[model samples]
Target chain A: MSFTVEKTIKTCRGKLLKLSHNSAALNCKMVLNVYIPKQFYENASVAKNKIPSIFYLSGLTCTPENCTEKGFIQIQADKYGFAVIYPDTSPRNVTFPKDCKIDPNDWALGEGAGFYLDSDTLENFQMGTYISEELPQSLASSTDLFEDKIDFLKKRSIMGHSMGGMGALNFYLNSFERNSNGYVSCSAFSPVVNPTAVSWGQNAFKLYFKDYEHEGKKLDPTLILKNKDFSDKNLNILISSGDADPFLENQLKPQNLIDVVTKKNIKGIRVNIEPGYDHSYFFVSTFIPEHCEFHAKKLGLINHLIK
Target chain B: MSFTVEKTIKTCRGKLLKLSHNSAALNCKMVLNVYIPKQFYENASVAKNKIPSIFYLSGLTCTPENCTEKGFIQIQADKYGFAVIYPDTSPRNVTFPKDCKIDPNDWALGEGAGFYLDSDTLENFQMGTYISEELPQSLASSTDLFEDKIDFLKKRSIMGHSMGGMGALNFYLNSFERNSNGYVSCSAFSPVVNPTAVSWGQNAFKLYFKDYEHEGKKLDPTLILKNKDFSDKNLNILISSGDADPFLENQLKPQNLIDVVTKKNIKGIRVNIEPGYDHSYFFVSTFIPEHCEFHAKKLGLINHLIK
Candidate 1:
């Protein structure tokens, strides 16, 4: 995919830089914001230290800019001294059916719904490869700002909001656990747990995969947990859901994963059901710090200063 | 004025009930989002304890919803056991000439430019009374949510971003010298320090006040500091501005206040010029916790829980 490196600003500590990159990753040229912590900037000798990093996936139809724009993850990342990578969900080049619908109810399926899965049925959607594999490799190999900053080997975690939460879980279960350095932990907010059952998920899944029942299992954490034997890896899983979330009953049923984990005795899964929180960033921002701290501890980088 | 009350769910918290009231004072219907700390719901009597509170004022054209929607203050508020009150800017009943213009250059004067001052020329724009006096009274008298729960007389600090920063500073200066019940420190993000000098301020001043220069002094901290004797107040002031802020040279000239405070040897004022930061919330969120801690210390609230 063709891309353009736009601008880079060196933060106060001089150890981190906020770089904005415009890329034609999926199809439409997208703006991706990457926060490269101070470590890579200061020590060019240790550039290839292969520090573990995390990709913060955002919800449906959200450009990489939303997380950078509204989400305050950069502060926490600075504190944790980790690189934060953000990528857009879907390329805007391709148009889907009913793309212009304004109803919030239809928001989950159309524009924002990349589902973070590889599309087997459609030609345009290859986001699954773009994010999990291609994006990481590009960042690692390119001489751009993120080259030495992203350490995919040491330790890593995956987290997101709404549809991004589903992406985090799907990526963690399907690929990150097997490929990356080590799985520290994964957390999500108001996530769609059983994608095969919900309408939002059904629509996106049908568009992405051919055989719904079989292929959907690979993307559904609830289904994957029933058969995948990841308990031996000591993965620390934290899921936060607001009971008052408008999509809770219909789309984001955290209970689905709880039931699976309970039945299988999943070792390191903790679900926090927040009583009054909804599906907005307010809910995600509340618990995001805990997730960062969770990953920092396992990565053994909690006390490590950015310099 | 008519009003509506909407209950919202906060992640891991009990409930967030918003009071939407139309304020005849400001000629605008305002909404305040109140997050009743989990402690309040867990213990019914805690509601009567007169807990410490913080008032978050948003910038031009923004309602109480902006901070709640994207700012992520509630999460920290919940963790710190403090009640957060978000009051809208000006009333919607009155629309100025600069409302809803698409040009970025017109950002300071138009739809988003309430300036947080009482308009002497425009009868409808008495927003100063709304924020400083009427709003607090309404919070205490009309709502059970804040009446017994908030010690308006005890621990309190005001904060805001952009135009809201100007409001927070104005409110603090007016309220702090009197040794108001909850006179804690105050902070601002990319605040408009000299509203009289910039185009945004000039346009807003002409619309709001008959004597632009003299009335402009009421909103500008630099102008207020010349006549006001804050030497004895022991008020804490934290002002953060980005070196790269697009408005730095024109509208939000924070250096104006810094120069005054430095020359006068202002004891309690602390100015943080964060390098590489801009006019975005990312800049604000980075140092917001420091401002919270600053207020928490003076308010005698527990800061241990935050870390």
Candidate 2:
């Protein structure tokens, strides 16, 4: 499918480009924002060496704009000299049932919650493949992005908020072995840690995974982490949750992953539970810079500074 | 009328209080968020000394929350030792004709753009007096706010963005002489310089001032400056406009004030037309700290370092 760059501006010491493309992967037109670090613009050879990249996934009902506006990740990315990509959660033209009980505008289900999984039920919801495979490939093929700007050969890190966070974890776990570098690191905020235990996840999983007999086994990150076998790639895992987050005990139980990691003796997982933050972007913005810097260091783009 | 304190929390350095009150001046129920600096909290007597105060008026469709969320003003306020008061634009419950051809949901018209003028036409829109008179009087009378923490006798500074910028300028020029020790400083971003020329201001002013005799007289900061017989009072006016601001040229012509002040020999007006910045909060946040410090020194709260 062909895509066109809409607008590009130099900001935060990087080039931010908004692009639109007709996607067979998404089955509709979609838009995404890509931020190429000044390392690419200033020194073209760094990108051709395939410098490390990070993908930022946004939460439910949000568009590519939210992360750009409130996430405050660009500043950190600029400091770390890493490329950042933000993909919209879903395509346009998909209509939910009016009596679907879930209001279409509720932001949790219909639009912004792609959940980072391949949908076998909904005709249009093949976003998992689009993000993990096709979109990355497209980004790699485009000289404007990859030739001298991004080092496709380098390791990559993924992180997101709410649904996007769940998507990041699921994508990392599912595709951990495909890339030669393996999954470098992954993190999430207010993620649906145990999808089988929550209402939003339940409704979304039912819509996307319908008749898959491996239902409980497939979408749950904890279950996947336990059952999937792979060489320990030295993945640095960071998870932050707000104790005061209204959904922490219910939808976003960080304890689920903690329990599994403890049983499995996973070595490098770091979980920081904050005291009084909430589920809003205010909470996310406060910590997102740290996450970006964490991944940037793991991917070998920047040295971590002890502040 | 009686008012109730809704909530208060001790932030890292200071206290934040949300108060609800029946505003007889505005003729409606109103809410305000007041942040008292750490100095005032430590020494109660400082507030009664009439220490300098800076009032921040928010733009269209925003409440106290917008400034709190994105403004990044607290750190500067702490450094400068100033109290920050954010008052809502206007009360709800005013009705407009359906054919007014304005989208009621648009942030500019219905909810956020109070225009900071008493509405002679709408029964509910007498917010101008509330902001200019009653609100300040209430702050002065409330011993908890002004007794030892704020020195009303000291010079005052005012600043704002978009509609709020217009409000600050109007209020500063109109009422600065009577209530304030000096118009120490004033600044704005993308302010409606000529209300008679812009759609947002035209619609708001038409509804606010029903009598045509006051046409182009009330809430027109440039007009007030040109026609009113008032001394300059050595007000330190630092006005900035983003050249790339979408509203510039049409609504926020900083040149208007520059042209007037240049001809009138207004000694303290400093106009800065920034290049490439837009109308977003990023632009405001970048320069807001400087403006605060500018006022802090002028108000005698802090001694100016000899440059």
Candidate 3:
């Protein structure tokens, strides 16, 4: 659980800690950025209320820098007094020969395309366990993160963009099975909700698992949601997508996730299709306030805009 | 005033228009990104209260995308009902050879460093006339900008970071000499206050002007503040610099501006030295809300935080 602090930048009301640590799950070194809000800094030593955390998973072709530099979540995080953890999309410093019919230059097959899912075949591709389990455990043991002030284990939520959104939904649903205190809520921005129905998922899933047609269905958020009972959990979810997003039609099947929710008559899921927005950070930043508010309210934080 | 729309992106409560137009002033195809607040979009045709505009100048080696993508000014502009104009730092695609001692790889010389000063030596680098004069006129003539709804001619202010910050401070102080209803307020983030005293200013100034030492003083914000009278205009200015900014001590002498304001007994100029912050976009984005509110109040807009 040992970590190295690469850089600590002062931003908003607190600091953005750029950290790199070796993950036993993924084997290679992993890098992540954590934004600790001013509330934790002000009350780290003597506070009755523990600060909740929100893990923001990034999409493909992204380092932690993409969102850390552009996501604009620090403002809302500070306002709502929640810590934001920006984990790497996948493990780096990876050196392996091409496998699973993957081209040497396919961005969706390796490196950044871990899909936050543990490979049934490969030990190195366990991104699901990395993000959902190992990453949280690593953060909990890092005292420099003010573990006493910020809760990394139970009182936390998960959110992601594009491919990460699919991961967030699947992780949030499957998390409760592992522990009673799972994610408080989940949200996504232009997320890939149904991997089984999309090309990006079908292609990548085929590469990761030995039998993607059978193994990939288990990882699909839409498939998981239909069978997963969320009545006990209340299933707080907010999914926002841009109508003008180029990937909306084929790659991101937002409707698949929406259909399951509607058919199951689930409550607390607000799927907003915003007008004139695309899949860039412009779209993510536009609705970050909404997602932040959604997670903030579910986490029992006082958001000025909400109440 | 012929203009081409590069791209229009949806963000916050409005749209960010990426534009490129031939500048008659600089004799180059200048690119800029403008964020028109939702207020203008809502009331472009039939509105009595015209939406005021604010120009944002970016620093060295920056295109309009630097601030447009990562600056995070859209939220506050939407909140304050102000348009933000992000102009390119310097002229690009210059066919002129380096005359007065410039390395082929120097970032501060040819392309990105216009220094926002008209070259008494060259015609292609009239960035001072371009930003302060021609850009406003070009924007006004561009009917797609909805000139009727947005007031680009008057009630507009200027602010920037680094070299752009120097431009904003110098232009704000010198703007009234060109037009009566000049910039209502001026602000900077780690601005080059004493351009004559800094290496960045000295290097770039020598490259731009024939008489750098003598002519550079005329463009220095700190020097101009001493001689320039602002009693009638009630000059409103705000400056913020990070203590941890690498360039703060050498390139950006923020204290030089503060000292002149103190010695000259200038009111409405608030200089804040923030501890632990740096020169990155994190610093700019962190302090954007404050600068927005500062400009909003001076423009007679109701900022929720202030009132």
i-RMS, each model, one decimal: 3.6, 4.0, 0.8
lDDT of 1 by residue, A1-307 (tens): 4336666654423332333333434655555767766555567534545566778889877877777656666667667667777877776556654633335476665456778876766655777777777676667766555555567534667788888888888887776456743346677878888888788788777667778778887888888888788766666777888887888999888898899888988888888988666777667766777788887887777656555
Candidates, ranked, DockQ: 3, 1, 2
Distance (Å) between predicted and true CA of B194, model 3? 0.7
Give the residue spans of candidate 3 off by over 4 A. Answer: A44-46, A98-101, A303-307, B44-46, B98-100, B229-233, B303-307
Candidate 1 has a TM-score of 0.86
Q: lDDT of each structure?
A: 0.71, 0.72, 0.85
- Per TM-score, the best of the predicted structures is 3
Candidate 2: Cα lDDT at A212: 45
Provide a comma-separated list of chain B TM-scores, one per candidate: 0.87, 0.88, 0.94
Best by DockQ: 3
DockQ for model 1 equals: 0.38
Error of 1 at A279 (Å): 2.3
- What C-alpha lDDT, on a 0 to 100 scale, does residue A111 get in candidate 2? 69
CAPRI classification of candidate 3: high
- Residue-level lDDT of model 3, residues B1-307, one tens digit each, is 7779998898887998889998888787888898988888775432667788999988888888998889899999988888889999888887775565667698877688888999887678899888877888878877766766778889898999989899998888887787744898999998888888978888877877888888898899988887778777678889999999999888888887778788878888899999999998999999998999899989888743344
Report the error of model 3 at residue B13, Å: 1.4
Compared with the true structure, what per-residue lDDT tens digits does model 2 show for residues B197-279? 67778777766666634754657877777776556465677776778788898778778877887777667667787776677
